[model samples]
Target: MKFSVFTASTPEWSPEQAVAELAAQGWDGIEWRVVDQPASPDGRPGFWAGNLATVPLTGLEEEVPRLRALTEAAGLDVSGVGGYAPCKQHDDVERLLAATRALGASQVRIVVPALGHVAWGGRLPTGGDYPELFAQARDDFRWVADRAAEHGVKALVELHHTTLTSSASAAMRLLDGLDPEHVGVIHDLGNLQVEGFEDHLAAFQLLGPYLAHVHVKNGAWFRDEVQGDDPLATVGWHHEWTPVNQGMHSVVEYLRTLKGHGYDGWVTLEDFSTELPLAERTAFNLAYMRRAWEEAQ
Candidate 1:
């Protein structure tokens, strides 16, 4: 199996720094994020880090091959390109794909707009009319699939809370008639560590066939007193980021399940642990994953 690190995890590093550090740290591939050109608000906190591992949407006619050479010299692969390409929009996909190919990546991450109550890495507010949004998203996802095929790339729909593609069944539904080769689902365990989590066996049963890649991060839920202004309001537990071995999700079991289903694709570490330094955190994450893989076998 291949191991990778999402550029978001090392926001403090430039593209060259990320490649050099990760290559020395034992990462096999990079899940590249394209946001130097500001694709959308879907760009995460990492975007603020001027020292970020990213490919710009423009100037890829020259920059892509240079970046590719730099990464190759470090003995790493440009695994995938990640950006907030909402299914509702399409005015910028050609530029995004141009950068993706220039970076020598075959996959791209697609995020559907947040429709219902969300949480953690993104928004979580009161409910919206998810059913109505779902109706629109069906057509939107199909359009994305067609576009990915036209660009000679596969779109990996990332599962996030409160989106139409959050759950296994929902993800399967969004990708139903689309060719898995042209468009697929990313089984992101970190995103799934939420209040209403899905069953592992059941989720994989539905999603395994469509799984083009996977991303993992570990964190545990903790109770935080919400000193609410409303007397009628009730408090709840929220997820807090932690190192790899200290999370709610059973990554070893998750990996074993993937292995059982013949998934040898890239497994990326998206460390959101702000408590530790980036170098220490990345080293710990990679070591934990290697140990987990050995034990899984």
Candidate 2:
């Protein structure tokens, strides 16, 4: 149960700068984003999306070693690779695997893309074309798991918004279809807040065994009757993205649950708050996480 910070939180800083900041904050490791997007590349568009079509595959082999050295010099381990794999194309899985290998990552985070008009934070759209969409994703994940094993990496599907596994029950169904040895789950507590804290815990209990990775964050929930909106949409959560101890989430309970389940993987902190300065927010979160780890022990 080591502490790591997802570099996405400091998108404005260069990887070298981000590592130095983390070292100052006493973080043990880093989870680097390896998606094939210019926004995440070495230069330009530091915190915003860049033209994805212009992304090049050349020089990746050379860049990886340099980045690895940079991280190691800062006394940080490359925990995992955060990636995206669209189910529409099988080749995307292969590309993700190659990137993971280059980055020397042991785990790869994948998202099941959203398709069609679906209610915000509601269950995946079903019926008609949905069956085909789900079938494709099922097979796509299976193929990804097999490919990931070949590269000595595990594929952990994120419990992301608007995906087939957006909820605990849905994620359980998806996990049941895949082999846990190759395919596992990354539980994002903030994403589950749409359903409420109790529901989030229930989902975690259900998916406990398959949990391979964890994202630490928090959110508040409410309902808006005027728009006849789903309860998930009325969430007025704001500072829910603050440091571990500052937010409403119970880090002590979360750590207890993880230990009870024998989960010894990286508990990476991902703060998506735009209000505070990035480095300050990350430093605060890192300090809070250390406190939580000490309390847990």
TM-score to native of every candidate shown: 0.86, 0.79
User: Candidate 2: where are CA atoms >4 Å away?
Assistant: 36-62, 118-129, 195-205, 222-243
Per-residue lDDT of model 1, residues 62-134, tens digit only: 6777888888999999778886656675755656666666677888887676765655234455366788778
Q: List, residue by residue over 1-297, the lDDT tens digit for candidate 2.
A: 688877666677677787888887888888876555545455544433442212233445556777778888999887777765564456766776677677777787776756445643233644336556666778787788788888777788787766677666766676675767777888887766643133545666787667778888765443323456566554443324544564566777777766766678888887776666777788777777777766865
* Candidate 1, backbone clash total: 1
Q: List the residue pairs that clash in candidate 1.
A: 118-124
Cα lDDT of candidate 2 equals 0.68
Error of 2 at 241 (Å): 3.7
